[model samples]
Target chain A: MDWVSHAQAELRGAGYRPGAAARLVLEHLDREDCCRGAQEIFDALSTGGTKVGLASVYRMLERLDERGLVQRIDLGDGIVRYEAARDAGHHHHLVCGACGKVEPFADRRLERAIEAVEERSGYSVVAHDVVLRGACANCRD
Target chain B: MDWVSHAQAELRGAGYRPGAAARLVLEHLDREDCCRGAQEIFDALSTGGTKVGLASVYRMLERLDERGLVQRIDLGDGIVRYEAARDAGHHHHLVCGACGKVEPFADRRLERAIEAVEERSGYSVVAHDVVLRGACANCRD
Candidate 1:
């Protein structure tokens, strides 16, 4: 996991100021290894001294997405969510609508089908996000 | 194709007034096949002197959706789109983003995967809609 220093460097490369807010988001969400919304990130970063607004969180996250440091997911909600792009492996998500629990999984077959569509359609497929949403284990019981 | 009278009967059965505006929208979108959005349906009825407000179009369409007379699709666009649901079997769409054209296809492999997930998780999968968007051949050329 990229710690605070490395995350700050990433922000600097992405042309954002190496501020405390940006570093806090990168490190915390990168460590979580799952998708999260901006409000959740703000909660994680809130401290007595550190000041971060939800709007700033959204702006910083959008900047990270532009820099390829993170990916934004729509998740059928009006608000967009983010997951870190560290290690750069392809994967998809399983979301629990009941509890909002998210599980990330790597599915090769689905990826191949997407690639096939790209090749056949002549659309240079930049990125694809596959999501499967349903009730999770505990939610069923 | 369900004409105005039958649609009026269906609506009346559900206690909806068979108002001219509602009937206009119903007739405009009630193709033997294909779905139609509120804007398209409104424009189609406008030429015929139907005094349908766009808000009424939206509300009537939402009511149709609730009554199983129509289906709404995301299309990845936040704008809610309505489609007539007569003979509306389960299917998915291949949308050409560049041309705004849509084609429908059915793949049992996809259905099986949904079934597999439902069976494995014991979650009663009600329904699903898959949309694949890309630039079409003309758009590429």
Candidate 2:
């Protein structure tokens, strides 16, 4: 099977209810690989012929996020966005101040350092997000 | 100088706008280290006897954040919250799913690793955030 089918199967294997609606979301985000808001996803979904409603789109994505199938990104913009989590490994966020594009990244060193900081400080490090906003290649060049 | 004064000095050194309301905010956040939403801030300001208005608080915090004087944290909630960001050098966030408590941490190694990932992936890594949801001390214990 191809990667998309594998992904869909994995998600279903994890107990996600199926519909052309949720599948369209997963496939679109899988191919796009960019942080997208609900509206953007809805727009893309409609263009792709699923004809899903916005409320269902939002709800499906929310479930996906809860299931660890997606990640929610906040770019300091008024809107919230989502991206498919590449894996269960450590991931980080980068946001383009110029165009509001978001990218995900990972680093083990930072994870160790964070553990050390949590140990040193009384505050237990539970979770964190680091958003750097600046011009991206598309905006800069 | 006292800790609060030291904070003011830091802001001044960084060229951020400084004033009584800002100072008050710094002190409040230092004591709590909790993300206070803008409305909570307005309420606190009203009770603090500085005759501070909500708009003034908003503007002051905006300026402070621009200078990296404080941290603006988005909890994926509709409202963005504020904290002092004291010695907050390169930290991550941990959020409680049940209680809504947030903790900050730093992990340099993770930061570097994320940088490398961005580089290899053709993404320009600027900044990132990692948020984990779980129970906190108060909630768990």
Candidate 3:
């Protein structure tokens, strides 16, 4: 079958009943290799003739997140963005406080610090989010 | 001459109009040294007989955040929590994925990593938020 069907089957194997919204959202995320807000996903689905409710999109996103099928990024701009999990490597975000742009970034030192925290705190770090807020280059110019 | 007044003065100095909601929100934040969600702030204000809408709390929090008078913490859940910026030293948060408990933490290594990111990215790096999510001790049991 297709990638979406395979994902749905995998989720089913993991005891998650993947619905149409989940399939649609996962397909959209797969097509666009970037983070997307719930409203953005809803709008894109609607525009693409797959009408889905914002609440359903949110619910599906949360389920997908719980199942490790998606990665949720919170940039602290009152918006939560999601991207499909492919290998689910750890990353962070650089947010432009002036223009509201989000850029994904990976830092070795930051990862090392997280490992240090995990070693000291006795808390297994399942996931982490780091967002640095500042003016982007364009905004600085 | 109190903390709220000082925050208002600072906001005014930064060309921000300190509204009644902002003042009240600042007062609540100052009184409580923990992160608070918008609804929690609104309920507290309501219980204290100082009527304020949830939207107003959110707006004031955003304004206070912009003025560096408040720190917004995103625990990767849907809600964004706010705390008054005292001395405004940088810190991070450890969040319980199961119980939604948030614990504030400071790490010199994490701070150094942020400084490294600022040096490398050339972004002013006005602020940074780090959320480490895992099961707390209680939840781990």
Which candidate has the highest TM-score of all? 3
What is the docking quality class of candidate 3? Answer: medium
> Candidate 1 recovers what fraction of true contacts?
0.11
Model 2's interface RMSD: 4.1
After superposition, candidate 1 runs with Cα above 4 Å error: A1-18, A47-49, A86-106, A131-141, B1-18, B31-49, B67-69, B75-77, B86-108, B131-141
Per-candidate chain B TM:
0.79, 0.69, 0.88
Give per-residue CA lDDT, model 2, range B4-103, as digits (tens).
6776787788776578777776676667656788788878767766566787678767866776666777777788887765664556677777677677
- Note the DockQ of each predicted structure: 0.27, 0.36, 0.67
lDDT of 1 at B61: 81
Q: Which CAPRI level is candidate 1?
A: acceptable
Chain A TM-scores for all candidates read 0.80, 0.71, 0.87
TM-score to native of every candidate shown: 0.69, 0.71, 0.84
Give the whole-model CA lDDT for all candidates, comma-separated: 0.67, 0.69, 0.82
Among these predicted structures, which one has the highest lDDT?
3
Cα lDDT for residue A139, candidate 1 = 82
Worst 10 residues of 1 chain A by lDDT: A121-130
lDDT of 1 by residue, A60-139 (tens): 78787766677666666555688877655556666777887767666555556555655654453345555666677788
Clashing pairs in 3: none
